[model samples]
Target: MASWSRLGRVGNLAATIIAVAGCGADDVPLTPEPGVAARKVTVIRGDQTYPMTAEVIDWETRPHPQVPERGMAVHITYRFRSTSSDSSAISEHVELQACAVDGRRVVLLCTSIFNGSSKDCWLGPSADPDLARTADVLILPDQMYAGPHAGDPKDHDGYVPPRNLGPGDQL
Candidate 1:
């Protein structure tokens, strides 16, 4: 009877361990709902302050004619309106700062603005769409680059690459 009880306890412990191990950090949901995914972050750069909202509008994983590997893409929409009305206070080149995927954070070294008013715009491919849904996205304002620097460095001209901004520099 004692040996049987010990075996049962060991089985229970094994089951408990399996259950705990199966639940990873990525299993925690970041967004409460599908559409209502948004986070507000305030950024202060130099003498300027930008009140911004970063929202995950859409996520997709599809084959791209350009990318044979069929990576994931995340679409993040941003709205920014400076508290100050001064033209100098206008937020320019607002872009993503970093994204956290399964606890691993990747600084967005490359990003783009899809479209928006002076107060609104969209930026994305946050990570690969495959990884974006499982990641926490963070956006911030930084100097925008002019050309294609994220892709092949040799394919573009005058592509002055921008350095990844640290957390201290971002929101």
Candidate 2:
């Protein structure tokens, strides 16, 4: 039994040495691509102009959740000035860039305060100006507030999306 134990220890040490040597191979140097800057713009909903920062987050291609055979999930982050006058608002819109002819952008989360408000809407892409355009100035009415959502919709004021929106001249 003692001899068997000694042999097992020797075998384990040999395996470790082989593994270490195998991992000590020369590696090819990698050249990273240039970094892309985030597009900073403003969205005018109603009376207030909300500044926005848009970023595209790409992930490994995967099957779509809804349509397993032919779909994929694309993610994006949209940070803008919190709509709330009293507090700051920072929310994210994550959706799958479907392959459909007129794919719709979905809102995954509207995080405000601590709770998340559910919002489902189809948004056009920025590439297709006809479909989606950056909102440089957001406008809102005096009675209505455009801050992030509260526990209830009535908890906050209503808002109107900005028109003639585009990327800001200087970001």
Candidate 3:
């Protein structure tokens, strides 16, 4: 009889634990949906030009589904070139232009993130889709940037920020 009572108490405790866990799950927030699918572009260095794969990394979005309200806007990164000439361009600043899948004009800016470094570019508060134009291919010197997140007020000043490669490597 004593053993039966103990078993009953254990069952009650297990049920209470599961109920608490289920209730806590509801408190968790939802991750912000990714803004758009990754877009590809070509990278140009000096006189050489080639097709390259890149994706935009958004900072406003949450990293994990359990942790919402953390992620941000979508951005781009160097992926294909890493195994090719892209990795060799490390520390060498290059320019990349974004074109619509249909090859239409989008937006252009001096980006140093092409070197496959942690650098990231944050779209400023004034960003407008209508005004967005395809980036002009050009060469420039290496530039040092601040943090990779959009929380920085300076990120809106037309400068691309840098972030750890691992954290922002994926779409």
How well does each candidate superpose onto the true structure, as a TM-score?
A: 0.37, 0.25, 0.28
Please give the lDDT score at residue 139 for candidate 1. 44
> What local lDDT score does residue 25 receive in model 1, on the 0 to 100 scale?
60
Candidate 2 stretches with Cα past 4 Å from truth are: 1-40, 51-54, 57-61, 65-67, 77-159, 162-171
Worst 10 contiguous positions by lDDT, candidate 3: 161-170
lDDT of 3 by residue, 1-171 (tens): 999999999999999999988986854443332222234334432234434434443232112344324432223333334435555544444433222111232232223444445545433222223113323222222123322542455454334422222111222
Off by over 4 Å in 3: 1-38, 50-53, 57-80, 85-87, 97-112, 116-119, 127-171
Residues 70-123, model 1: lDDT tens digits:
454444445554555564534455543433233344333224432134333223
Candidate 1: residue 116 lDDT (0-100): 38
lDDT of 2: 0.31
Report residue 153 deviation for candidate 3 (angstroms).
Answer: 39
> On a 0 to 1 TM-score scale, where does candidate 2 land against the true structure?
0.25
lDDT of each: 0.42, 0.31, 0.36
Clashing pairs in 1: 72-128, 72-129, 72-130, 73-129
Lowest summed-lDDT stretch of 10 residues in model 1? 29-38
Better of 1 and 2 by TM-score: 1
RMSD of each: 16.1, 20.4, 18.8
